[model samples]
Target: MAQLDISSSAISIPTLLIVNRYFDEVTSNIRERPMPWEGYQRASLITEQELLLLRNYSSRTGLKDQPTAEKYIDLFLILINKLSRMDALQYILVAFDDTIQKFPDTLVYLCQLEVKSEGSPFNTLKRCLGKDDDYLNLKAAKIITDLLNHASPKFVQTFDFTDLLLWLNRQLQSENPNVVDVSVQILQGLLKLRSFRPVFYGKAHLMNIFMGLIQASREGNPQMLYQLLFCLWLLSFEPIISDSLDKQYGVISQLVAIAKGASKEKLTRIVMATLKNLLVTAPGDNLAAMVAVKLLNFCDNLATRKWTDEDILDDIEFIRQELTERFQKLSTWDEYVSEVESGHLSWTPSHQSDAFWKMHASQLAADRGRLLNCLAHALNVPNQDPTVLAVAAHDIGQFVKYYPLGKKMVQDSGAKQKIMELLTHPNADVKYRALVALQVLMSHAWDQ
Candidate 1:
């Protein structure tokens, strides 16, 4: 690995300047290159030639008192940023990884140099539908990717990656799928910052990023696709952005495809939760389509599984209830009954209150236990009748909704699962009543 003393100031400018003049003709013409939409390309990355230049620059930077130490560090990084080959970049990173830490100012200039390179009309990353081979853009993107991978959050932010964010937006529009995928990856990293996220969200250009992520989700590799979904999750945190993104892309179908193809390997829960957020913000018609595709079953199946993670279970439960409620609206009473028999009915409407069960306030606090015991006894009588179970489910649903006390009682007792299990009863009415009970429980849980 190559090492440079960033604090040193003793260097032969005349000797290095002579070497640079010799290599300028043989290697990259890295002077003050302009950025695209911002100028022209000036650097070339011939690896062998760059190695020689990097070595010469590294050696001369050793003089501790040399005031020009910062300048040497700055120039070497500029040349590194312009490197077009991954192998060349990997070499630079390995060689100077430790040395770069001593100079934040050099990191800042490296970023500036990347921007300038992209602005060159010959820039590789700036393309749309019709395109030349995206050499410069692709190379620049790879450098950015590597830099982000190895950089500290402080380093990246200190250099103000917001301009890099803007540059990435342009790359995402490129016709070359490779460029778009890499661009999404960079944006995904940038969104980790609360500060940087709003910069993207503050403007209309966010829509472009939204669409780009969705497109990449479909076409990108597994890692890229996962990052894309995670990025979508972050974007979904804003109600307005998620709503607008849904209006533009209606990504439910894409999300569904991803879920279906997930192979139960990784990201299934995150993908499902993101789908829930999208469902919450989605238009009515879009939500109805979600129901038509049986989204509730998707989550219910996952939520009921013993191995699901706690957060994932909670996420699935939330989506299950939300999707079920919408499904209930779309389903007929008979259809809901069918769902019960098939163990597919997941939602119920609000429970109806029975006048006889409504307690007086003063006695309510004192006799709550007595009232719950009486209800539990009535519901727990097995094989008595399906009608009894149905009534029990309905009554409990109403009691839980109107009185907060009922939730603790039901949770402490076996009533919660028993009520849920009734959805599988042979009699459709019994199953329907169980659905009513579960809906109330779900609503209460949601409130908690």
Candidate 2:
């Protein structure tokens, strides 16, 4: 007879309460603390009948009765009592591997079982990262990532993200780019953990996680770059993170390089989205200004992006609008170098809008940068769009003629060369507009 650890009172067979009573009796004296590897040992902990049941279940190529298997939940309870460190880890790892293979149809159900436990397969996998089976470690890491991506937060949070990040960070130093890439991907999964936060993953002794992420963006791996950019997009939501990226590493510049160099549509789109997230957080920020300038690199070929993916096009448009709005609000009077160069109008308004105290002269004259940027954009891409060039040149003419210290500062912007380039333009109206704008800006020289 299989003896209970404690005595059980007999009750009717088919009821759940009676079953619990019997289970309580069986396990009451069972050891609460298990040795790790005890569960993995060939010497099974459950009754002979239970062992025979599992043996019968294992013999079949398929699961005939999954619910009946569930009824044998005491397998875990018994192991939790008897398993030691090594065997417990080995048990879960084998179970994870077998569950994936044996129950392809029950994957979600089976993975959920491991995911919600602190001692689950991935926790064991994390420990194995420094072990000799790196290939298996990566394979297991990938499986864990896929599981965590789909797992519920309640289950995902059960894993310790800090430890996972530290392990993955160490793996980033692998000689194989594929290894580094997989490690980066696993770190991406760590970001999705419910309790995950953006604490710096440590550079005091080793390469910090964010540094690795930034470096990956600049390196040649598109897959790694995509995952890194995705994390940055999420991290950018936090002020501490966004500010650290800007103030400490100037990561925004690296992101621009990545976006500019990326040939893949998906890679470019994520890089673009990541930049947008960073810029949107503090539009008036210094890095925002640099990023705004960096973003202009695309202006010369904006049409190529117009036919790109709809999602990327939307991101481009968002960046465009935000930059335009932010720059408009940024005072440009301070940037005007005319009077300082010409030694006239010794003092200018502190505000660009105040430059138009002579209201109705032209809004363009009030902000010199806006007019210069407008003309530059037109002259670059609107080479054939004459009306764009015309309006832009007309704005420059007004800015040069009416704004304080206009001619000197406008000339200092290299406006003369742009105007000369347009003078021979094929479109008569565009040529005329450039000619007029230049005449106004250079009128002082003619007068002198």
Candidate 3:
């Protein structure tokens, strides 16, 4: 610990005047040098002892009012740049804590200078971040983040870093679009640096904070949302960090919902790409089924348009092909039952599982009367598709086959009349389902 030597009253008055005159000469000489960036490379060649002297002088009582503060700050930044260039960052690391504490405002201004540098600030930061000292790097990261949070739009816009994730987080909370945009850009840059990966992962709540940004995009900030989603997508490519199921499911669910409702074709395509990325990375039976169900709903909506029958049929064929492929991947009913019985089914389909389609199939086969009531409600909606109606009817017929009680419920509830009317539907699938349901009812009556 170097002590301040301000109490040396025994020193001659002439010596003090000479020191003051030297200070004036030094300040005057500093004016001859070019701007900070121009002189940074050369001035940073100064020796450690000289650098310490400058540091000490910059901290003297009258130094703040003297022109020396700005010059010293500039010279220190040159040293930073040199450290970055010569890879002598450990030396800077030893002094960074005290340097920042004594001149917090200087660190902020140096960050601005780095941002304005012509060469890559990202690469420079990367060199500094690669030092073996974690505490120093973390301190530097904190300072950079603080500076970026309060930096003007111009400074923030040109900023880049490989260890500024903390600052990126602060920028994420900014209300300014330009700041947010630049911050995201900076994050993207940092993410590309392999050295920063551990730092990024160590920052807890990072994934959740990003997801919150994704959710915010739904209300009209798709640009920021898209940037965040893309970053998450890129991150998911890394096996070690991307293995968390909660992070995967949360991001995917939001993306899938957005894809389903997005009117813009490009955004829809991007969302679809994100979904595909997720599936490729962490495919599960339930997730596959949920995707299939969403695709089916999309197809059903598309079918209602008054297009040529041939075009509609072609679209339906494509959708059916996709659904069939996905459905084949779903666990069979017997498999599900076995899993449930064996306690292997940790997730319930009704709540977290996307097996609602299969559940619908099962309920219809075991309880026609309940199926009929559900159909009644579905049919009441205007512009309801006949295919959905037919599927419901087929499910009901299956229920009647497995459960005699379903027929009793239908007959007792007068749902049989509705089933008979559906038999006259123009769509063959609906008529077939309706006829099959009615025949099952008649058979039950005859058996009795």
Candidate 4:
């Protein structure tokens, strides 16, 4: 929409032009050719002169005629509701897409019309989403996206987009790359609307789709990957979504992997921005999770590279500094918990700190010895890192020496037998740690 003084809105005109042209380019090919007037007349829809006027409206701009716009909208609704023929419907949709984009008055006018029943133009387009033809579905989605972009707050609040949002969710998993791309781009736009966030987020399968796309995009689809990450970047603005993304969906590891290998500058920029948002939104265990995934190391490496985008560098610097500061602030127990939960343990300070074990051993024994059981599982897993086995064995011994029921807990967790078997391990570090832990388990007077 433009202001009464066109000069005031001149700066935004170019951006508007780009958006309109892009929609025109990606919409159905039916817009290029003339409609089958003979077939439409055979179906008794409209006269030849009326079709010509509609065609003119499609190409015309700056249309300020209210009556003409309403007439065209009614025609589109009639064609959409009455016409079962796919091509005819597509022709009408192509016209609708053009008219609404070029003529602001028509878009505003259409949005103002209240929907009284299912056969409304908006609802009709929604129904087209279920059509078997991908082109029709795409056109329908584009129109819906366009409407929502300009629709009044009242209309958006009352409208039920659950079906449409679910369809978009399913379409993200589509094998067809174009469908997935368009769907993500639509979602990216929709998420910009604050009211739409909870609606889309409420869908149970949204995160699952994101997880799959994050994994799939790693196989070399930069456009799809960027678009998918863009949606995540938008969603990360919400504190609740950001929290769930890391805690429940485990997206930090996947996103970190993408950021680590992003070839395109834009891809790296978005991934960095998203990681930054997720980090800043909630930074307790989330920070630990990022650190455990070696994101800080990645940020360190990223910081050394020459980045053109200032935002990218800023995000990298911020994340690196935040991870570093918070990591230092993390308690010995928090560090130990992060390492064990990451499933990639190493010889960190916690494993050897006598005071750490003495202080947190009972805390580890608090959750029914959950952290202890995790260590026992890591110890028994075949082909685990010898350092990890060694660390696990040492922690078990420390737990036994500190906690009253640590020995029985180790036996219950099956780590006692695993530790005994590890005494014959090929790695000397693992064998020695196993022997010490076994002695502690047997209540022997072993030296610290």
Q: Could you say which candidate leads in lDDT?
A: 4
Candidate 1 structure lDDT? 0.52
lDDT of 1 by residue, 267-375 (tens): 6766776776676655443464454346677776666567445666667777778767656665343342322222212334312324433532122224455544434
Worst 10 residues of 4 by lDDT: 6-15
Winner by TM-score? 4
Give per-residue CA lDDT, model 2, range 1-448, as digits (tens).
Answer: 1111111111111111111232233233222323323233346545566455445444543344555434333243344344444434344333444444443433355355675663454554555544454444554465555555545556555545555556665677777655666566556554444245344322433335556556855666566667777666655655555655654554665666676787687777776766766776654343443533346556335536544577777777777776666556645432332211111111223223434534534444446565455455545553345765665566566666666566665667666677789888889987998888887767856764
- What TM-score should be assigned to candidate 4? 0.78
If scored against the real structure, what TM-score would every candidate get? 0.42, 0.51, 0.39, 0.78
Candidate 1, which ten residues in sequence have the lowest lDDT sum?
10-19
Off by over 4 Å in 2: 1-132, 135-160, 200-219, 284-293, 297-300, 303-306, 333-448
Q: In candidate 4, how many Å is residue 181 off?
A: 2.0
Model 3 spans > 4 angstroms off: 1-162, 192-202, 239-249, 285-323, 329-448
| lDDT (C-alpha) at residue 143 in model 1 | 40
Model 3 Cα lDDT, one tens digit per residue, 1-448 = 0112212211111101111233234334433333323233356566665556454653444344324444554544455666443323433432343344455565455555666773433344445544444433433443344344434545544444334565556657767655555556445444433334445765667655666777877777666666666566555544455445333334544555776666454455455444444444554432433342355566566555454334334534455465557657656553333222221122334322334443544444344434446545544445556755665455455555656566666555555776688877788877887898788778877887
Backbone N/Cα/C clashes per model? 13, 11, 4, 0
Q: Tell me the TM-score of model 1.
A: 0.42
CA shift of 445, model 3, Å: 36
- Give Cα distance to truth, residue 150, candidate 2, Å: 6.9
Q: What 10-residue stretch in candidate 2 is worst by lDDT?
A: 9-18
